[model samples]
Target: MRQSLFVSILHDIQQVNEYFIQTRDATGAPGLSGVQKMTAAFQILQYGMPANAVDEHIRIGESTAIAALNFFTRSIVATYEVVYLRSPNEVDVARLLQEGEQRGFLGMLGSLDCMHWHWDKCPTAQAGAHTGHYHKPTIVLKAVASYDLWIWHAFFGMPGSLNDITVLDRSPLFTELTRGHAHTANYTINNNVYTIGYYLVDGINPVGQRL
Candidate 1:
């Protein structure tokens, strides 16, 4: 590895590390036992190339490389919505709220929509959801975000095998938040303080409080 690789990687991994604080530490997890693992994850997400390329580039195994990529990909989902404020203890729930306010999109820090990332192939069982639903296979990332560029929530790993709206409805954020159970210890959001209420900008979802 180049000397600068770790220097750049260490910084990125630390943020991801904070998010994956080992289940031992406050339910934070997808933790890494060694720097190599975080390094591997960073390389995958930053580059988005196949895992083999990362493994060969870093001289690690294909499985290890794939695992690392998966870790960070989820890490983005887990932490993207959280905003660190002035103090470590203070996370600004309204951190991004200001942007929407200024943009005449007040009371909106998050947008309710489904974005798709293209995929190459669909598996046998999974093909049902992917068939003609989209022109191509895609992993749908359904998320809610604030205007300050802080993502307050995300639902990931929905197989390209399905429609964006269906995936969103079944997303953990949607189910729990709608049922008013989102704040339960087993349920969640950034800072774990979210309630039955979550903020999202409306588009395509024409009903009251859509997923």
Candidate 2:
């Protein structure tokens, strides 16, 4: 993240919740600043560091670091969820279609893929169900990302034991299409007109199939 963007998010989060603000201890000495708290949270998130690991660099205790991370994530979602975590609107669809046309794909929305993240702290009892070809407990995250690097759709928390096809079957990416609430994308390809937009996917996913 850029310095300006991080500062912007920090400022917004500070406004949304006072938990991130700095305060003085009972001895009248200054305590941890907002920067320290936010930095602790960011370091843990960005590097997947343990709570106690931040103590060496940020001077935060394990419990306090964990609390800061929880509060920081909640504050971010509460402040920016409506604007940044939603389905694309009509204008967004139109722009995407135009970009697709310019790129020689008449109605392509983006690329679809799945990634597996190792679950280091997975419970032993449930580890068998989450273990996949990677031979370890993991979680899957399926996403559709456009050319501009914007993620249009995200579905997470699926077991790594499931393949991309199984994950797609359970994903809500096509919920709008099934409910007839999706925007129409009219385009011509080899004299055939396609009304629905399409996402580019690897061979693992069946082509010419729409939900």
Candidate 3:
């Protein structure tokens, strides 16, 4: 994370949780600061390290480190989910259309894709239903991301036994569009005007079908 961004997060988190602050006891021994706890959690999350490994460098017990990770995730969502996680509105759609036109993709809203997140701790009995073409237990995350990497839509937790087609069938990203509630984006291409927008997709995704 950027220095300024990290500082902002730290400041906001402090407001949300006093545990992040450094306090001194009567003997002047300092308790664990919030930064250390949050940093340990970040390392474990970013590097996929075991919870116990953070004890060596962070001096936090394994159970405490786990609690920190849980608290950190919840705090982040409570703090920034409204602004950073919202779907596009009318103004947002207009901006996306402008950006897409500049990039030669007229009426393009975003790029659509699905990724398989490996489930390492999947139970043996559940693995059979979760195993698909990858031959491993996984969960699907279908997303529509803009040029700026803003993920406006994400549908997760689908069983891995399904393919891209099946996943899209279950995804509600296009439900609004199908219901004619999607934002209007009229754009010109090849001297012709069109109203429906499009999203770039990989070959594995269903094509020549209504989106």
Over all chains combined, what TM-score does candidate 1 have? 0.52
Off by over 4 Å in 3: 1-8, 43-53, 178-180, 188-194, 203-211
Clash pairs for candidate 2: none
> Residue-wise lDDT of candidate 1 within 1-211, one digit each (tens)?
6768755644555576553333344576443444666666766665566667765556667786777666666655555434432111113434434444565543443566676676554566665665445766677777664443434556777776666567766887655446764332222334464322335544533221343
Best by lDDT: 2
Which is the winner by lDDT between candidate 2 and candidate 3? Answer: 2
Worst 10 residues of 3 by lDDT: 202-211
RMSD of 3: 4.6
**Tens-place lDDT digits, model 2, residues 94-202:** 9989988997889988778888899988899989999999999999988887777677688999999999899999999999899999899999999999999988887
As for candidate 3, its clashing pairs are 20-34
Against the true structure, candidate 2 has what lDDT?
A: 0.87
- State the displacement of the C-alpha of residue 99, model 2, in Å, after optimal TM-score superposition: 0.6
Scored by TM-score, the top model is: 2
- Give the alpha carbon lDDT tens digit for every residue of 1-211 in model 3: 9878877898898888776778999999998888888898899887778899989888999998998899888888878788777789898999999988898888988888888889888899999999999999998988888887777788999989999989999988878889989888898878998888988888622321123
Task: State residue 148's C-alpha deviation in candidate 2, in Å.
Answer: 1.0
Model 1 segments more than 4 A misplaced: 1-9, 12-39, 43-55, 62-99, 174-211
